[model samples]
Each structure stands twice: as structure tokens, then as C-alpha cells.
Target chain A: MISRLRTALIYVVLGLGALVMVAPFLWMFTTSFRPVAEAFTLPPRWLPGLDSSLESYRRLLASDVPIGRFFWNSTVLATTVTLGYVATTTIAGYAFARLRFPFKNALFALLLVSLMVPIQTTLVPLFLLMRWLGLVDSQWSIIVPGLTGAFAPGMSGVFGIFLMRQFFLTLPKELFEAARVDNAGHFRTFWSIAVPLAGPQIAALSVIIFTMTWNDYFMPLIFLNSVDQMVLPVGIMSIRDPVGNSSATSEVIAAVSLSILPVLLVFLVAQRWIIDSFVRAGVKG
Target chain B: MTSIANDAAAGWFSPQNRKETIAGLLFIAPALIGFAVFVAGPMAATVVLSLMKYDLFSNPSFVGLANFEAMLDDRRLWKVLGNTAFFAVFAVAGNVGLGVVLAVLLNRNMSKTVQYAYRAAYFFPSLVGLIFVAVIWQFLFQRDIGVINYYLGLVGIEPVRWLSSARNALWSVIILDIWKNVGFAMLIATAGLQSISKDYYDAARVDGSSSLRTFWQITLPLLSPTILFLLTMNTIGAFKVFESIVVLTNGGPGDASRSLVMYIYEQGFKSFNMGYASAISLLLLTITVIVTAIQFALSKRWAFYE
Candidate 1:
């Protein structure tokens, strides 16, 4: 009887905590369906009942947000960045992991340190460089810089190479030896053998990069000046001018819901894979 | 012998292979060059610019540590730094505490499906960009029409101007930040919990230990490594807090929420005082490195990586 009581207590505490964790999102869901006036009704309407309407969604769709254009831009930009990152990081990661060359450790060290340097420090020089290349306000500026997988020699992604290298180092040397005996070159062995076997790491890296790029706002905010080029996060910012007198609460909530839902869905679908990768990597490597 | 000959013919060391190496470099060149120009080059520039005096258009003239001298004398700089430290400490502590509690709860074997759904819902806030989250919370905390006040009205509590008062604004921002990021800390901690073997719990039960006692004596001790690592990451992130402040409070009503990064952005971009801004950025970076180093040094005492 005591044990059962303890178990029930644990469940109650856990359930209450989980409710707090989920409350804001539930409030978001409730408010999105609520009319402007009804959003803050007495006693606080916590859920969407019969009176809940789709008006906010309609307003979001009908607003000057160009929600479709923003979505397209985000998709294209994220895809391009992810693909570019994969191609670059794979070769670079493999080289750092397996291949031998002069100053390899030194170069890799430089990359690691660069990863530590925050983006704010480099914004001015990067802006100037972009202006020099006449690439400011263009998609290429975002895509090209993003191609720098694991960040630059001096910031964010030096660890990318390290993570990938850890995985690569664990592969059996016998596979490489056998390939070499069969007259396969390094490149051929890498593609035919290593690449095919590296499905999990690739998936892990791709998902991480996709999520990073998807949630990125600062880079796009600084670079893309026009409405047509605005990504979802930045596009959403233009909805309510911070100084405007208009009540943009409902519209902004709809935009937030739209921006969040897709990524949340992706994360849900890939949660198992993500967790698996981390566990395997953390334990074995 | 045939394969050996082919290996020789393929010539891994041949002049042609050097060209292939160059091509490989070419394949990775875009990323490499971008990194060099944008990240490395700019960082070096920031360091150099910090030593000089420039206001955007004019060529920077080296002032030989004047920027640093100015930063030391600037009272506003110190205030912002204190605010940032306070924010980082509280926010990190709150998230870490909340994360551990949630992880412990979810670690149980029953009701796993409901737990997963709740985790997803919590993580949804983090999926949206910081600015968007700010927008939602801005309305939620508004003095008049906010749902928070609406609920408070029932309890006969007067509406509070959450973002208007100097004393309340910073705390409100911190609360928003804690809510935004607690889910992330929970995920990391939960992942750590999943890695722990069930044998630990079983052994404790065999020894006649209660569940709470088992958690305290076993689980928390074992989870120290993950907690340490996550604490370091969370502290660093909280120190760099910017967007939410920018959107919600704009470092007002009276510079209450003016964090170090916001100050850097304002000085650098808004006022175009590149030299002064670079100095502030350097100070912020120094604080980050110092704090991270201190954490690493102290982690040796408790972080239990096998």
C-alpha cells in the first residue's frame, strides 16, 4: 500500500511538471484559434471550444507576409546550405580523420579555435567582404558562407570535423586494406566503402545542419534586405513593426505556429534517429 | 601480383595524384575560403579594430589601447556586464534545475507515449526563431490585453507592466528565456538518463532502497558528466542572449534588459562606432572564455566521464 502511494505521488508530480512544460504551447494553440477579443476573456479561455475560429489562420494567409514566398525561400536556402555542407564536411572530415598531410593537426587546431570565435565578432569584416564581392543582398552570400561546413578555420563548426572524424576513426582498417589490395584508390575506397557505411553519421549531420539552417535568423536578417528574399524567421519579424500601434497579436501567433509546426514535425519524425546517433556516438566514441 | 602491379600503375604517389589532391582541395574550397574570409579574417579584424578609433566611414587610426581605457571608465559598460552575468546565472540555473527534474520523471518505464508527446510540445518553443518567440511572449506579458493579466484579474491582482518598469523588465526577460530554453536542457538531460543502465535501479531495489533514495544516491551521481557538459553549454548560450531582448524590451524601459551582446550590436551597428563596439565585443568574448575555463577547471572535481 505504501509503495503504491509512492508511485502515485511520483506520477502526480511528473504529470504536473509535464503540464507546465507544455502549457505555453497549448496556450499558443488555443490563442491561434481564438478571435482577438476572445483571446483574453475572463477566466482565461485555455482551450479551443465550439467558439474557436480559423480567422487568425486566414489573416496570416492573407497578410503582407508573403508567407508562401518566405516558406519557399527558407526551403530552398536550407536545402542548398545542407547539401553544400554535407559535400564539403564529408571530404574535409574524412581527410582530417584518415588521410595524412603536412600541418594536418595544426590546420585542424586552427579550425577548432575558429569555431570558438562568435559570429558577432566577424559580422563587420564579413559585411565588407560581401560588399567587395558585390554579393550583398543576394542568396549566394548566404549559401556560399554556409558551405563552410564546421564553420571557418577560426568558429562554430570546427567540432563538426571532430565529430565526423571520431566516427571515421572507428571503422575497421581491414576494409581499407582490402580495398587497397583490390587496386582501389583512396577516393574509390572512400565512396564505395566508407560512404555507403556512413549512413547514420550522414543522417545525423544532415539533420543537425538542416535544423540549424532552418532556425537561423541573424545571417538572413543582415544579408537579405528585400521582401522577396526574406526567410521565415525574418519575414515574421516584418509583420509587426515594433513601434506600430496596430495589435498584431493574432497574426503573429499564426505566423509563429506556421514557422514552428513544420520543424516540430520533422523533429518528431527523426527523434529516434537523432537520439540513437547521440547514444552511439557518446558511448562508443 | 596483378593487383600489386595495378596498384603501382594507379600510382598513389604519382604526380597525377598531387593534382587529384588539389582537386579534392577544390571540392572543399568553397567552404574553406568562406571560412577564411568571413570567419577567420573578420575575427582578426575585430581584434585589430578594437585597438583603433574609427566611426565606419573614416579610416581607423590606431589609438594604442584607448578603446580598452574607455571601456574601463564607461559606467554603462559595467552595468550591462553585471546585468548579463546575472541573467546568465539565473537562466542557466533555472533551466538546469527544471531539466533534471523533468528527466527524472520521464525516465520511468510507464506512460512513455504521453511523455514523448509532452517533450515534443515543450521543444516546439525552441523550434521557432528567438524573435518569433519574443513576439508571442511580448503580447502575453502586455500590461492590458495579456492573458497573464487577464488570469491575474480573477485573483484580484492589478495588471503589471512587465516590460515597462526598470526593475521588472530584466527579470521578465530572464523568465521568457528560461521558458524558451528549458526544453533543450530537458532533452539533453533526458538523453543522458536514457543512457544509464537499468541495473543501477535494480541493484538499489535489491538492497532495499526506496526510489527517491535510489535517484539521489545513484542517478544524480552517475549523471554528473552530462550535467557538467550541459551546464557549460547552457551557460555559454545564456551569456550570448540577444534577440528576445531586442524584440521584447529593446533594452528598456531604461536599459534594464541591455545585455552585453545587445550593447555590442547597438554600438557596432546602430551608432557605427566600430572601434568602441569592437572593444565591447572583446570584453564579452574575454568574459566567455574566462567563465568557460573556470567551468572546465572546476569540472574535474565532479564531472564523472568514464
Candidate 2:
């Protein structure tokens, strides 16, 4: 009888924990559908009324903030950045794992230390460099910098190198020897053998990089000059008049919804792998 | 340095080793160059800039001791530092504690679907941009029409002015910060939990130790490394909480929520006083490095790694 009661209590606690964990998201979805007047209605209307309109969507779409332009810019920038990181990280990771190199360990150590540098410290000099390049306000400013892989070259590429190296280290060394004996160059062998084996790690890194770049506000805020090039986060900043004097609730909700949905969709699609990657990275670290 | 010389000697002695050094450098070059220019270069500049008094218009005049001296005298610096410490302490404590509890509950022994569902739901906020997360929470914390106050009113409770009032705003921000990131910490904790051999739990069960006792004695010790890592990362993350605070309260209701980072932003960008801003940033950087080092040091005592 006691055991049964304990089980019931466990279920109750888990259920309540789940509710608290998910309530805010459910509230976000419901609140987005809520009419401006009803969004904050007493008793906190858990569900939007049938009359909750798409007027918020219309306002967000119609705002002078160039919402569409920002979305497009963010989408393009994030996509290219992810692709650039994935490509650079993959080829580099393969080399680190399989190829011979001088100062390899030292270079790897340097990269790891780079991760410790605070982002604020670098902002001024990077901004000055961007200004000097005549790239300030240009889309290339964010894009070019985003492409550069920071220290822990492999590891900081979301530790793509370490992960791939771990996996590589575990693989049969004979396969690479066979490829070399067959006169296949390093690139050729990597393309056929190593690349095929690296699918999961590549996917993991891509999702992580995509998420970080997409959600990044700092660089985009500093580098991108005009409304036309502002990414979603910065774009939202412009649209959001923190004073609450301008920009209605609907428009804000609409903007939030717009910014959120694409990444939300991505998360839903690869939820398991994303979770696994995070788990793996933490344990390995 | 010795290793480099050894590698060169070894490579020269063995013909096959010739290709290894070349390949290694080639492999690491892109990442090295990128890190150098983007991260390391700027960091070095920040240290230098911290010593000089420069606005954009003129040459940065050398004022080595003055800026650092001013930092010592600035009273607001202490308040902002205190505020940041409070934020890091509370947010890290709350989130890490909550995360360990949730991870324990959602261990591999739990229902698979339910675990996945909980993780997915909880991590939803983190996937979104910080600004969007803040915006969503803004409505939730609304004074008049906020979901929180509205719900409170339902229970015959007074409508709490959450973000608008200075008294509650910082804590309110802390609450939202915890909510957004607790899932991340939980995910990390979950990973650490999984790495432990199930044999340990099984052994404990055979020994007839209570589940709670086993968790305290075995699980906590096992998870300590991850806990330390999470604490360090979360502490850094909490200190860097600017964008969300900006979007949510704008350091509001006075300077109640003005974090060290936000204060630096105001000095550097808003006031355009490069030297003062650099001084504050240097202080911020010093605090970050010290705190991180302390966490790493604490790991020696508590963090049990196999």
C-alpha cells in the first residue's frame, strides 16, 4: 500500500513538473492567438477566444521595421554561416584526426583557451576592423566574421573536431592505410571514407551552429547598419519600443511568432539528435 | 616549445613524418587564423584600450593608472558588481538545483517518451532568440495585463508589479532567466547521470540503501564534475545577461537591473567614453576569469571523474 502510494506521488510530481516546464510555451502559443484586449485579461485566459484575430500577423507584416527584409537577411546569413562552419569544421576535423601535423596539440590547446575570452572584450577591436574594411553595415561584416572558426579549432567548432576525432579514433586504422596503399590522396580518402562516417557529428554541429548563428544578436547588432540587414533579434529590438508607447501587443506577438517559428520547426525536426549532441558534448567536456 | 623542436627533429629523422607536420599545420590554419584575428587579437586590444583614454575623435591618450584608479572609486561599480553577484548566485543555484532534480526524475529509467517530451518542451525557450524569449516573457510578466498578475488575481492575490517595479524586477528577470536555461542545465545533468554505470545504482539497491540516500551518496558525487562545469558556464551566462534584461526591463525602474555588462554598454556605446567603458569591461573580464578559475579549482575537491 505504501509503495503504491509512493508511485502515485511520483507521478503527481512528474506531472506537475511537466506542467510548469511546458506552461510558458503553451501560454506563448495561446497568447499569440489572443486579442489585444484579452491578452492580459484577468484569470489569465488560458485559451484564446474564437475572435482572437490574425490582425497581429497583419500588423507585424505591415510594420515599417522591414520585418520581411530582416527575416530574409537572417535566414541567408544563418544558412551561409552554418554551411561555412560545417564545411570548414568537417575538413579540418578530418585532417586533425587522420592527417599528420606540426604543433597540432599546441594549436588545439590555443583554440581551447580562445573559448575563455569574453565576447565583450573583442567587440571594440572587431568593430574597428570592420569599419576599416569598409564593411560596416554591409552583410559581409557579420558573415565574414561568422565564418572564422575560433580557438579549439575543432572543439569550438562546437568541438566538431573532438567529436569527429573521438569517433575517428575509435574507427579501424586499417581503412585509412588501405586507402593510402591504393594511392588515394588524403582528400580522396576523406571524401569517400571519413566523410561518410561523419554524418551524425556533422548533423549535430550543423544544428548547433545554425541555432547559435540564427539566435545571435551581438554581432548583427554591432555590424549590420541598416534596417534592411538586421537579423531577427536585432530586428525585433527595432520593432519593440520598450516604452510600450508604440507597437501594439498584436504586432509584438506577431513578430515573436514570426521569429520563433522557423527555428521551432528546425528543433522539432531534429529534436532527438540535438538533445543527444548536447548530452554528448557535456559528458565529453 | 620543446615539443615543437622534438617534432621537427623527429620529422627530419623520419621521411614519413615529413608530411605529418605539414598536414597538421594545414588542418589547423583556418581555425588558428580565425581565432587569432577575431578573438585573441581583439582581446589583446581590449587590455591595451583599458589603459588609454580615448574617444573616437582623438588619439587614445595614455592614462594607465587613472582609468584603473577611477574603477576603484566608482561606487556604482560596486552596486553593479553586487547585483551581478546576486544574479549569478541565485540564478546558478536555482537553475542547477532545479536541473539536478528534474534530471534525477527523468533518468533513463523513466519512460522514454515522457523524458523526450519533457526535454523538448523545456528546451523550447532556449532554441528561440533571446529577444523573442524576453518578449514572450514580457507579456507574461505584464503589470496590468500580464499573464502572471492576471493569474495571481484569480487566486485572490494582489497583482504583483513584476518587471515594472524595481523591488521585484531583478528577481523577476532571474526567474525568467532560470526558466529559459534550467532545461539546458538539466540536459547537461541528464548526460552526466547517464554516464554513471547502472551497476552503481544496482549495487546500491542490493545493499538496501534508500533511493534518496544512494542519490545523495553516489549520484551527487558522480555528477559533481558536470555540476561544476554547469556552474561555471551558467555563472558566465548569467553575468552576460544583457539583451534579455534590455528587452524586458531596460535595466529598469531605476538602475535596479543594470548589470555590469549593461553598465559597460552604456559607458562605451551610449556615453561613448571608451576609456571608462574599457576600465569597467576590464573589471568585468577580471571577475569572469577569477570566478571561472575558482570553479575549476573547486572541481579538484568535488568533481569525481572516471
Query: What is each model's TM-score for chain A?
Result: 0.89, 0.90
If chain B of candidate 1 is superposed on the true chain B, what is its TM-score?
A: 0.90
DockQ of each: 0.38, 0.56
Give a tens-digit lDDT track for model 2, residues B1-306: 332222555653366566555665666677667778877787888878888888877888998779888888988878778878888899999899998988887784557877788788776676667777888888778777677777687889998988878788889889988888888889999999988988998899999999789989999998889888988888877877787788878887778887888888777777777878877777777777887789878888768877
* Model 2: chain A TM-score against the true structure: 0.90
Which candidate number has the best lDDT?
2
User: Whole-model Cα lDDT per candidate?
Assistant: 0.74, 0.75
- Chain B TM-scores of the candidates: 0.90, 0.93
Candidate 2 chain A, poorest ten consecutive residues by summed lDDT: A149-158
True contacts kept of 1: 0.33
Docking band of candidate 1:
acceptable
Fnat of each candidate: 0.33, 0.65
